[model samples]
Target: MTEHTGSYYAATVNKATDYPPLIGDQSADVCVIGAGFTGISTALHLAERGYDVQVVEANRVGWGASGRNGGQLIGGISGEQKVANHHKRDVEDLFGELRWAGHAIVRERIQTYAIDCDLKYGYLDVAIKKRHLREFEADCRRLEKSGFPHEFRMLSKSETSETIGTDAYLGALLNMGNGHLHPLNLCVGEARAAESLGASIYEQSPVLDIEKGHRAKVVTERGSVTADFVVIAGNAYHALERQLRGIMFPVKSFIIATEPLPENVVAQINPRDLAVCDPNFLLQYFRLSADKRLLFGARFNYFGEDPAVIRKSHRKKMARIYPQLADARIDYAWGGTIGVPINRVPQLGRISPNVFYCQGYSGHGVNVTHLAGQIMADVVAGTAERFDLFASVKPLVMPGAHLLWKPMVALGILYYQVKDRL
Candidate 1:
C-alpha cells in the first residue's frame, strides 16, 4: 500500500512509523530533507543539542538505501586512506578519531535508545588475492598501533575456512568492532528517538523546492518548512537538488534473502554471527539475520529491480562462495542505489552558507552517514573543525556523470573486473 520496495525487512519490521504528511507551513531552527539515516541522524543530533529540528521525507522514513542495505556495520569511512592522505601530517590526530566515530555513535544510539535491531558485534574482511592479504596485514598494524579496544586478528587460509565454513577466501581479517544489525529498524528507532527529543518529522512529503536566503525555506507541494538552516541528507536517492547530481555516481547494489536455514546449517556457516565481506571492486557480502536467513549481497552495475533477475544473478554469486546453499530457496530479492564519488570520499559541504549537503559515501552508508550526521550537526551548532575537514576536499566527479551514468558505471565495472584479475 506504500512505495517501499517489497523486501524481507519491510515484511518483518515490528511496527511501521506513522508520521503525518506535511500539510501546513512549519518552522524550526533546522530543517532536514530526506528522512533516511542521515536526515534522522542529523535531526537527532541537533535536537539533542537543544535545536528545534524538523525532518521532511519524500516517502516513508529510511525508504531508500538506508533501509535496503546489507545491514553490515563495517567500520571506517569509504576511502579513509585517500581522504587521510589529504591531511597526511594529521593522520594520527584525525583519522584515528574519524575512523571509528560512526561505530561509536551507532553503539551509543543502540544502548541509549534501546533500539531492538538485532545489533551484534564481529566482522570478517575476506581476502580474494594475496594483495588483499597484504592490505589486511597493513590495516591490522594500524589498529595495533592505535591500541584498538576490540580484538582483531589476521586469519590463515585454513583458519578462514574453519571460521566461515567456506574455502572461497584465501584468508581474512577479523575485527570485532565491525558488525551487523537490522538497519531499517535501526533507522525507525532513531527517528522515534529524535521525535522524543522534540524533533518533528513529516513523512510522504516530497520536497518540491528550496528557497535560499538568510533563512532557508524547504518547500513541499502542500507545506513548507522555514528554518535558519537546511541540510540535504538524501544521499543516492536524492534527485531534487540539481547541484548535487554530478558530485557522485548513483550505482546500484542487489541482495537476496534465503529461507531461514536450519540450526545445523547455520552452525556450519557463520557460527560466530559475523558479517562477512570480500575484497573486490565487484564484491559480495553476507550475514545471517535475526531469524537465521542468509542475507547475501552483491555489488554490480545493474540498476533494475526485477526479483527474478536479481535472484538469478545473486544466486550464482552466492553459490560460488557457499555451494551448500546452491539450492536454497530465495524468499526476497531487491536492489538499492549507492552514491559513489569518483575519489571515494564522503562529500560534506555547503550549498550555501546556511544550507549544507552530505552524500557520496560510496557503499559505506551505514557507518559514514552516522558520522556525517554528527558532523553536520556540529557545523549547524557553530563547530566546523570536523565538517571543514571534509568540506575542504574537492569532490572528484566523472565527466557527464549525470547524463551517462549507466554506461559509465558499466565501463567502470568492466575496468575493475579486469583489474581484479591482475
Candidate 2:
C-alpha cells in the first residue's frame, strides 16, 4: 500500500482509515479513480444521489496533493476572471453562484457528516502590490453585488500589520466565507460518509489502463471495476490516461508546520484565526491550525522530497513575514503536485461519452473539487449545463509537457518569480 506522506495533517487526523485494497472484480453504477478530493467528493455526491459508486486509489485516500495542500478554503475557481472574460456569454448570469458553489457544498458536508476538520470561516488576501489591492477591491465589489452574507473588510497597511503581526503586506481583504481546515481529515470523513452511503473505496489500487466500451472497464493490477460510467478524477498524480496528460503542467508546492504557538503569540498574529494568502504566483499561504500551530506553505522551484530542505527553505521565508518565528520549531514538512492548465482554466470533459474526467483546478482544488464533484454527478445523471460550460473552454494541450514537467515547472517558477518581483 502506498503510505501517506508524513504531513502534519496525517499525523493529527481525527482517525486513521484502513480501506481494503481492490482485489476482485467489482461492478458499480459508477467507478471513480483516485481517492482524493475529486474522486471521493464525486463518489459521495453520486452515492448520495442513490448511484452505486466505487473509488479506486493508487495510494491511501487523500495521499496525493489533496492530502498535502495548504488547506486554505479559498473561494472561486482559479482564473475565474479569465474564464468569465473568454466565455462571457456562457457564464454571464451564473458565475456568481458558481463561484462560491463549492464553499456551500463544503459547509454542508462538514455539518452534515459532522466532520471535525477544524473548519473555520475567515480568510485574508494580503496584498504585496498596488495591482493586488486593486484586485481585492474588485473582489469586494463582486461580493457586495452578489449580496454575499459574509463579513468582509479591507485592512489598511497599519491594520494589516496589526492583524497579521506582519508588515509584509500593504493591505489585505478579509473574507469570512473562505477559511481553512484539516483537509486530510475532511477527505477521510467524506470517504467514510460515502462508504456509509454504500460507496466502495479501495486503496492502493493503481489503475493500469481503462477499456472504453458500453460499460467502461477500469483495469488495475490485481483487479478491475466495470461500471456503466467511469470517472477519472485524479488531479495532478494521474497517469493512467494519455489524453489527460500534457494539457496540464504539474507544479510542486511545499508546506511546513511549526510547533504549537503560545496563546499570546497567536493573539499577536492571526488574532481572528483567519487563513492568510499573499498575491503572487509563487505565493505564501498560512493559517493557524486548531491546535494553534502555524502551517505555512509556498510554491518553490525545488521539486525534491526532502523535509529538512523544505523546512529550512520555508523557515527563512516565514521569518521574512513573521520574524518572531525565526526560531520557530518546525514539526513537519511535505510537498505535493498541482496540475495547472496553460490558460489556467480547469479542463472538464470526456475521454469518451461514457468516460468522464475533471481536473486542472490550479490551486483552488479544495473548494472547486467539491463543485466539480457536483458537476461530475450532474453530467453522469444526464445534466450537462455546468460541465458544458467548462468543456466549452478548450484545454491547451502541450505535447510532451508531462514528460518535461519538472524542468518546465522550474522554468515557469523562475519566470513567475521574476514577474512577482516586478
Candidate 3:
C-alpha cells in the first residue's frame, strides 16, 4: 500500500484507513477512480441515492492534494466567469447559488455525519495591492446583491491589522460564509459515511486502464471492476488516462505547520480563528489549527518532499508576514500538486460516453470538488444541466506540456511572481 505522506494531517487523522486492495473481479453501478475529495465525494453522493458504487485509489483516502491542501473552505469556482461568458450569461445571474453550492454541501455533510474536522467560519481575503482591494470591493457588492446570509464587510488598513494582528495587508475582506477545516479528516469521515451507505472503496489499487463499453471495465493490477459508468477524479495525481493529460498543468504548493503557539502569541495572531489568504495568483494562506498551530502555505519553486528543505524556505516567508514567528519552531512541512488549467477553468468532460473525468480545480479544490462530485452524480443519472455548463467550455490542451511541466511550471510561477509584485 502507498502510505500517506508525512503530513501533519496524516499524523493526526481521526482513524487511519486500511481498506483492502482490489483482488478479484467485481461489479458496481458506478466505479470511481481516485479516493481524494473528488472521488470520495462522488461515491458518497452516489451511495446516498442508492447507487452501487466502488472507489479505487492508489493510496489511502485523501492521500493526494485533498489531504494536504491548505484546508481553506473557500467559495466560488475558478474560471466561473469564463464559463458563464461562454454561455452568454452574466456570471452572477448564472452561478450565484451554484458558486456556493459546494460550501452548502460541506456544511450539510458535516452536520449530518457529525464529522469533527475543526471546521470554522470566517475568512479574510487580504490585499497587498490596490487592485486587490478593488476586487474585494466588487466581491463585497456581489455578496450584498445576492443577499448573502453571512456577516461580511471590508476592513481598512488599520482595521485589518487590528483584526489579524498583522500589518502586512493593506486591507481585507472578511466573509463568514467561507472558512477552513481539517480536509483529510473530512475526507475520511465522508469515505466512512459512504461505506456505511454500502459503497466499496479499495485502497492501493491503482487503475491500470479502462475498457470502454456499455459496461465499462476498470482494470487494476490485481483485479477489475465492471460498472455502468466510470468517473475519473484523480486530479493532478492521475496518470492512467492519456487523454486527460496535457489539459492541465501540475502545480506544486507547499505548507508548513508550526508547533502549538503560546496562548499569548495566538491571542496576538489570529485570535478570531479565521482562515487568511492573499489575492495573488501565487498566493500565501495561513490559519490556526485546532491545537493553535499556524499552518502557512504558498507556492515555491521546489518540487521535492524533503521537510527540512520545505521548512527552510517557508520559515523565511512566514517570518516576513509575522516577524515575531521568526524563531518559532516548525513542526511539519510538506508539499502537494494541484491541477491548473490553461484558462483557469475546472475541466469536466468525458473520455468516452460512459467514461467521464473531472479534474483541474486550480487552487479551488477544497470548495469546488464537492460541487463537482454532485454534478458527476447527476451526470451519471442522465441529468447533465450543470455538467454541460462546465463541459461546454472545452479544455485548452498544451501539447507536450506534461512531459516538460517542470520547466514550464517554473516559468509560469516566475511570471506570476513578477505579476504579483505589480
Best by TM-score: 3
Q: What number of clashing residue pairs does each candidate have, in the order they appear?
A: 0, 0, 0
lDDT of 3 by residue, 1-422 (tens): 57988888999999999999999999999999999999999999999999999999989999999999999999999998899889999989988998889999999999999998999999999999999999999999999999999999999999999888989999999999999999999999999999999999999999999999999999999999999999999999998888988889999999999999999999998889999999898899999999999999999888798999999999999999899999999999999999999999899999999999999999999889999999999999999999999999999988998799899999999999899999
- TM-score between candidate 2 and the true structure: 0.98
Candidate 3's error at 86, in angstroms? 0.7
Candidate 2 weakest lDDT stretch, 10 residues: 85-94
Shift of residue 356 alpha carbon in model 1, Å: 0.5
Model 1 clash tally, residue pairs: 0
Estimate the overall C-alpha local distance difference test score of candidate 1.
0.90
- The CA lDDT at 366 in model 3 is 88
Better of 1 and 3 by TM-score: 3
lDDT by residue (tens digit), candidate 2, 1-422 = 57999999999988888888899898989999989999999999999999999999988988988899999998878767677777765443657788888999999999999998989889999999999999999889878888989899888999998888988999999999899999999999999999999999999888998999999999998999999999998888888789998999888999999999999999999898999999898999999989999999999989788999999899999999999999999999999999999999998999998999999999999999999999999999999988988888888888889788878888899999999998
Which stretches of model 1 miss by more than 4 angstroms? 88-90
Give candidate 3's root-mean-square deviation (CA, Å): 0.7
Candidate 3 Cα misplacement greater than 4 A, ranges: none
Candidate 1 — which pairs collide?
none
Kindly provide the TM-score of model 1 when superposed on the true structure, using C-alpha atoms: 0.98
TM-score versus the correct structure, for each prediction: 0.98, 0.98, 0.99
RMSD over all Cα atoms, model 1 = 1.3
